[model samples]
Target: MNTVTPVRFDNVNVGDALPALDLPPLSRLTLALYCGASGDHNPIHVDLDFAKEAGMPDVFAHGMLSMAWLGRALTDWVPQSALRDFNVRFAAITHVGESIRCTGTVTEKFEHDGERLVRVSLATTNEAGVQKLLGEAVLSLP
Candidate 1:
Protein backbone atom coordinates (compact mmCIF):
# COMPACT_ATOMS: atom_id res chain seq x y z
CA MET A 1 0.00 0.00 0.00
CA ASN A 2 1.16 3.54 -0.69
CA THR A 3 1.58 5.85 2.27
CA VAL A 4 0.77 9.53 2.33
CA THR A 5 3.20 12.17 3.48
CA PRO A 6 1.71 14.94 5.57
CA VAL A 7 1.60 18.25 3.75
CA ARG A 8 1.68 21.49 5.67
CA PHE A 9 -0.83 24.06 4.56
CA ASP A 10 1.66 26.89 4.48
CA ASN A 11 3.94 24.93 2.16
CA VAL A 12 1.41 24.45 -0.61
CA ASN A 13 0.72 26.89 -3.45
CA VAL A 14 -2.29 27.26 -5.72
CA GLY A 15 -0.38 25.98 -8.74
CA ASP A 16 1.61 23.18 -7.19
CA ALA A 17 1.17 19.86 -8.97
CA LEU A 18 0.44 16.61 -7.16
CA PRO A 19 2.46 13.58 -8.08
CA ALA A 20 0.90 11.67 -10.96
CA LEU A 21 -0.24 8.08 -10.48
CA ASP A 22 -0.07 5.71 -13.45
CA LEU A 23 -2.15 2.58 -13.09
CA PRO A 24 -1.51 -0.60 -14.96
CA PRO A 25 -3.55 -1.38 -18.09
CA LEU A 26 -7.03 -2.59 -17.34
CA SER A 27 -7.67 -6.29 -17.91
CA ARG A 28 -10.67 -8.63 -18.01
CA LEU A 29 -9.64 -10.15 -14.72
CA THR A 30 -9.44 -6.73 -13.17
CA LEU A 31 -12.93 -5.91 -14.36
CA ALA A 32 -14.25 -9.18 -12.97
CA LEU A 33 -12.59 -8.64 -9.62
CA TYR A 34 -13.80 -5.11 -9.35
CA CYS A 35 -17.32 -6.22 -10.22
CA GLY A 36 -17.23 -8.80 -7.46
CA ALA A 37 -15.69 -6.52 -4.90
CA SER A 38 -17.91 -3.55 -5.66
CA GLY A 39 -21.13 -5.57 -6.15
CA ASP A 40 -21.57 -3.84 -9.49
CA HIS A 41 -22.41 -6.79 -11.64
CA ASN A 42 -23.45 -4.71 -14.59
CA PRO A 43 -22.92 -6.97 -17.60
CA ILE A 44 -21.61 -4.13 -19.67
CA HIS A 45 -18.48 -4.09 -17.57
CA VAL A 46 -17.69 -7.77 -17.16
CA ASP A 47 -19.38 -9.64 -19.97
CA LEU A 48 -18.08 -9.05 -23.44
CA ASP A 49 -21.04 -10.82 -25.04
CA PHE A 50 -23.52 -8.74 -23.10
CA ALA A 51 -21.59 -5.61 -23.96
CA LYS A 52 -21.59 -6.53 -27.64
CA GLU A 53 -25.31 -7.21 -27.55
CA ALA A 54 -25.75 -3.83 -25.96
CA GLY A 55 -23.96 -2.22 -28.97
CA MET A 56 -20.55 -1.95 -27.39
CA PRO A 57 -17.61 -3.64 -29.06
CA ASP A 58 -16.33 -5.02 -25.76
CA VAL A 59 -16.57 -4.69 -22.02
CA PHE A 60 -15.32 -1.52 -20.40
CA ALA A 61 -13.92 -0.61 -17.00
CA HIS A 62 -16.28 0.71 -14.36
CA GLY A 63 -16.52 4.47 -13.92
CA MET A 64 -16.18 4.16 -10.16
CA LEU A 65 -12.97 2.23 -10.63
CA SER A 66 -11.52 5.26 -12.35
CA MET A 67 -12.86 7.45 -9.59
CA ALA A 68 -11.25 5.22 -7.03
CA TRP A 69 -7.96 5.62 -8.83
CA LEU A 70 -8.30 9.35 -8.61
CA GLY A 71 -9.06 9.07 -4.94
CA ARG A 72 -6.02 6.92 -4.51
CA ALA A 73 -3.97 9.57 -6.21
CA LEU A 74 -5.15 12.13 -3.70
CA THR A 75 -4.74 9.96 -0.63
CA ASP A 76 -1.35 8.83 -1.86
CA TRP A 77 -0.26 12.45 -1.54
CA VAL A 78 -2.01 13.34 1.70
CA PRO A 79 -3.63 11.19 4.37
CA GLN A 80 -7.31 10.41 3.97
CA SER A 81 -8.03 12.32 7.17
CA ALA A 82 -7.12 15.46 5.26
CA LEU A 83 -9.91 15.02 2.72
CA ARG A 84 -12.99 17.14 3.20
CA ASP A 85 -14.67 16.74 -0.19
CA PHE A 86 -14.30 14.59 -3.28
CA ASN A 87 -16.37 13.99 -6.36
CA VAL A 88 -15.94 13.04 -9.99
CA ARG A 89 -17.77 13.09 -13.31
CA PHE A 90 -17.14 10.40 -15.85
CA ALA A 91 -16.13 11.92 -19.17
CA ALA A 92 -15.46 8.83 -21.32
CA ILE A 93 -15.53 5.07 -21.29
CA THR A 94 -12.44 3.23 -20.14
CA HIS A 95 -11.99 0.17 -22.26
CA VAL A 96 -10.05 -2.90 -21.21
CA GLY A 97 -6.29 -2.72 -21.89
CA GLU A 98 -6.15 1.02 -21.41
CA SER A 99 -3.66 2.49 -18.96
CA ILE A 100 -5.01 5.25 -16.75
CA ARG A 101 -3.12 8.14 -15.24
CA CYS A 102 -4.39 10.30 -12.37
CA THR A 103 -3.20 13.86 -11.86
CA GLY A 104 -4.06 16.92 -9.81
CA THR A 105 -3.14 20.54 -9.25
CA VAL A 106 -3.88 22.75 -6.30
CA THR A 107 -6.42 25.34 -7.43
CA GLU A 108 -7.26 27.26 -4.30
CA LYS A 109 -6.14 27.74 -0.71
CA PHE A 110 -7.98 29.32 2.16
CA GLU A 111 -9.07 28.89 5.72
CA HIS A 112 -12.39 27.26 6.47
CA ASP A 113 -13.84 27.02 9.97
CA GLY A 114 -10.48 28.06 11.31
CA GLU A 115 -8.82 25.17 9.44
CA ARG A 116 -6.47 25.61 6.50
CA LEU A 117 -7.93 24.09 3.33
CA VAL A 118 -6.84 23.46 -0.24
CA ARG A 119 -8.99 22.71 -3.24
CA VAL A 120 -7.57 20.56 -6.00
CA SER A 121 -8.70 19.96 -9.56
CA LEU A 122 -8.24 16.36 -10.54
CA ALA A 123 -8.36 14.28 -13.72
CA THR A 124 -7.73 10.82 -15.10
CA THR A 125 -6.60 10.25 -18.65
CA ASN A 126 -5.77 7.26 -20.76
CA GLU A 127 -2.46 6.53 -22.42
CA ALA A 128 -3.74 8.31 -25.53
CA GLY A 129 -4.38 11.43 -23.42
CA VAL A 130 -8.16 11.14 -23.67
CA GLN A 131 -9.84 12.24 -20.48
CA LYS A 132 -11.75 9.52 -18.63
CA LEU A 133 -12.77 11.42 -15.51
CA LEU A 134 -12.74 14.93 -14.05
CA GLY A 135 -13.15 15.88 -10.44
CA GLU A 136 -12.24 18.06 -7.50
CA ALA A 137 -11.17 17.55 -3.92
CA VAL A 138 -10.88 19.76 -0.87
CA LEU A 139 -8.41 18.85 1.85
CA SER A 140 -7.62 20.23 5.28
CA LEU A 141 -3.90 20.61 5.72
CA PRO A 142 -1.85 20.77 8.85
Candidate 2:
Protein backbone atom coordinates (compact mmCIF):
# COMPACT_ATOMS: atom_id res chain seq x y z
CA MET A 1 0.00 0.00 0.00
CA ASN A 2 1.17 3.49 -0.72
CA THR A 3 1.78 5.67 2.29
CA VAL A 4 1.00 9.37 2.49
CA THR A 5 3.09 11.84 4.43
CA PRO A 6 0.90 13.69 6.86
CA VAL A 7 0.85 17.40 6.30
CA ARG A 8 1.58 19.48 9.37
CA PHE A 9 -0.59 22.44 10.29
CA ASP A 10 2.39 24.76 10.64
CA ASN A 11 3.63 23.91 7.15
CA VAL A 12 0.39 24.78 5.39
CA ASN A 13 -0.61 28.28 4.36
CA VAL A 14 -3.76 29.71 2.90
CA GLY A 15 -3.75 29.69 -0.92
CA ASP A 16 -1.24 26.84 -1.00
CA ALA A 17 -1.94 24.33 -3.74
CA LEU A 18 -2.17 20.68 -2.95
CA PRO A 19 -0.71 18.13 -5.33
CA ALA A 20 -3.04 17.42 -8.25
CA LEU A 21 -4.27 13.95 -9.16
CA ASP A 22 -4.84 13.14 -12.83
CA LEU A 23 -6.86 10.01 -13.27
CA PRO A 24 -6.96 7.90 -16.37
CA PRO A 25 -9.90 8.15 -18.72
CA LEU A 26 -13.08 6.62 -17.40
CA SER A 27 -13.60 3.28 -19.08
CA ARG A 28 -16.59 0.97 -19.32
CA LEU A 29 -14.77 -1.59 -17.21
CA THR A 30 -14.04 1.02 -14.60
CA LEU A 31 -17.72 1.95 -14.48
CA ALA A 32 -18.68 -1.67 -14.18
CA LEU A 33 -16.24 -2.29 -11.37
CA TYR A 34 -17.36 0.79 -9.55
CA CYS A 35 -20.97 -0.32 -9.88
CA GLY A 36 -20.13 -3.66 -8.33
CA ALA A 37 -17.96 -2.26 -5.56
CA SER A 38 -20.31 0.60 -4.71
CA GLY A 39 -23.40 -1.65 -4.91
CA ASP A 40 -25.03 1.11 -6.89
CA HIS A 41 -25.82 -1.16 -9.87
CA ASN A 42 -27.29 1.89 -11.56
CA PRO A 43 -27.83 0.99 -15.20
CA ILE A 44 -27.43 4.59 -16.22
CA HIS A 45 -23.77 4.23 -15.41
CA VAL A 46 -23.15 0.87 -17.00
CA ASP A 47 -25.81 0.03 -19.52
CA LEU A 48 -25.61 2.06 -22.67
CA ASP A 49 -29.02 0.87 -23.80
CA PHE A 50 -30.59 1.88 -20.54
CA ALA A 51 -28.89 5.24 -20.70
CA LYS A 52 -30.11 5.74 -24.29
CA GLU A 53 -33.62 4.74 -23.34
CA ALA A 54 -33.40 7.25 -20.52
CA GLY A 55 -32.51 9.93 -23.16
CA MET A 56 -28.85 10.13 -22.41
CA PRO A 57 -26.32 9.70 -25.18
CA ASP A 58 -24.49 6.98 -23.34
CA VAL A 59 -23.63 5.54 -19.99
CA PHE A 60 -21.72 7.97 -17.78
CA ALA A 61 -19.72 7.74 -14.60
CA HIS A 62 -21.52 7.87 -11.26
CA GLY A 63 -21.48 11.12 -9.34
CA MET A 64 -20.11 9.38 -6.31
CA LEU A 65 -17.28 7.99 -8.41
CA SER A 66 -16.16 11.48 -9.25
CA MET A 67 -16.57 12.61 -5.66
CA ALA A 68 -14.53 9.63 -4.57
CA TRP A 69 -11.77 10.71 -6.90
CA LEU A 70 -11.70 14.09 -5.23
CA GLY A 71 -11.61 12.38 -1.87
CA ARG A 72 -8.67 10.29 -3.02
CA ALA A 73 -6.89 13.44 -4.07
CA LEU A 74 -7.47 14.96 -0.64
CA THR A 75 -6.27 11.89 1.21
CA ASP A 76 -3.26 11.59 -1.10
CA TRP A 77 -2.12 14.99 0.15
CA VAL A 78 -2.83 14.48 3.83
CA PRO A 79 -3.36 11.57 6.14
CA GLN A 80 -6.91 10.26 6.13
CA SER A 81 -7.05 10.70 9.92
CA ALA A 82 -6.67 14.41 9.42
CA LEU A 83 -10.04 14.69 7.73
CA ARG A 84 -12.76 16.04 9.98
CA ASP A 85 -15.42 16.94 7.41
CA PHE A 86 -15.92 16.43 3.72
CA ASN A 87 -18.75 17.29 1.35
CA VAL A 88 -19.32 17.80 -2.36
CA ARG A 89 -21.83 19.02 -4.89
CA PHE A 90 -22.29 17.41 -8.30
CA ALA A 91 -21.97 20.07 -10.92
CA ALA A 92 -22.04 18.02 -14.13
CA ILE A 93 -21.97 14.54 -15.51
CA THR A 94 -18.74 12.78 -16.38
CA HIS A 95 -19.03 10.93 -19.61
CA VAL A 96 -17.22 7.75 -20.51
CA GLY A 97 -13.69 8.13 -21.94
CA GLU A 98 -13.17 11.44 -20.20
CA SER A 99 -10.14 11.94 -18.00
CA ILE A 100 -10.54 13.77 -14.71
CA ARG A 101 -8.21 16.03 -12.80
CA CYS A 102 -8.59 16.67 -9.11
CA THR A 103 -7.14 19.74 -7.51
CA GLY A 104 -7.24 21.45 -4.14
CA THR A 105 -6.11 24.59 -2.40
CA VAL A 106 -5.82 25.41 1.25
CA THR A 107 -8.42 28.10 1.84
CA GLU A 108 -8.15 28.83 5.51
CA LYS A 109 -6.22 27.84 8.63
CA PHE A 110 -7.29 28.37 12.20
CA GLU A 111 -7.25 26.84 15.63
CA HIS A 112 -10.35 25.60 17.34
CA ASP A 113 -10.80 23.74 20.61
CA GLY A 114 -7.02 23.58 20.95
CA GLU A 115 -6.72 21.83 17.60
CA ARG A 116 -5.11 23.26 14.52
CA LEU A 117 -7.32 22.99 11.45
CA VAL A 118 -7.34 23.87 7.80
CA ARG A 119 -10.11 24.24 5.23
CA VAL A 120 -9.52 23.04 1.69
CA SER A 121 -11.46 23.83 -1.44
CA LEU A 122 -11.63 20.93 -3.86
CA ALA A 123 -12.75 20.43 -7.44
CA THR A 124 -12.75 17.85 -10.25
CA THR A 125 -12.79 18.79 -13.90
CA ASN A 126 -12.84 16.94 -17.16
CA GLU A 127 -10.14 17.16 -19.80
CA ALA A 128 -12.10 19.95 -21.42
CA GLY A 129 -12.03 21.85 -18.15
CA VAL A 130 -15.73 21.34 -17.44
CA GLN A 131 -16.25 21.03 -13.73
CA LYS A 132 -17.95 17.86 -12.56
CA LEU A 133 -17.65 18.25 -8.77
CA LEU A 134 -16.96 20.99 -6.26
CA GLY A 135 -16.51 20.60 -2.54
CA GLU A 136 -14.62 21.40 0.63
CA ALA A 137 -12.85 19.53 3.38
CA VAL A 138 -11.94 20.40 6.93
CA LEU A 139 -8.88 18.76 8.43
CA SER A 140 -7.50 18.76 11.96
CA LEU A 141 -3.76 18.67 11.47
CA PRO A 142 -0.94 17.93 13.85
lDDT of all the models against the reference? Answer: 0.92, 0.90
lDDT of 2 by residue, 56-109 (tens): 999999999988888888878877888899999999999989999999999999
- TM-score of every model versus the real structure: 0.95, 0.95
Q: Give the clashing pairs for model 1.
A: none
**lDDT comparing candidate 2 with the true structure:** 0.90
Residue range 17-102, candidate 1, lDDT tens digits: 99999999899999999999999999999888899999999999999999989988998888888999998999999988999999
Give per-candidate clash totals.
0, 0
Q: Which candidate leads in lDDT? A: 1
> RMSD, each candidate, Å?
1.3, 1.4
- Candidate 1: residue 135 Cα off by (Å): 0.6
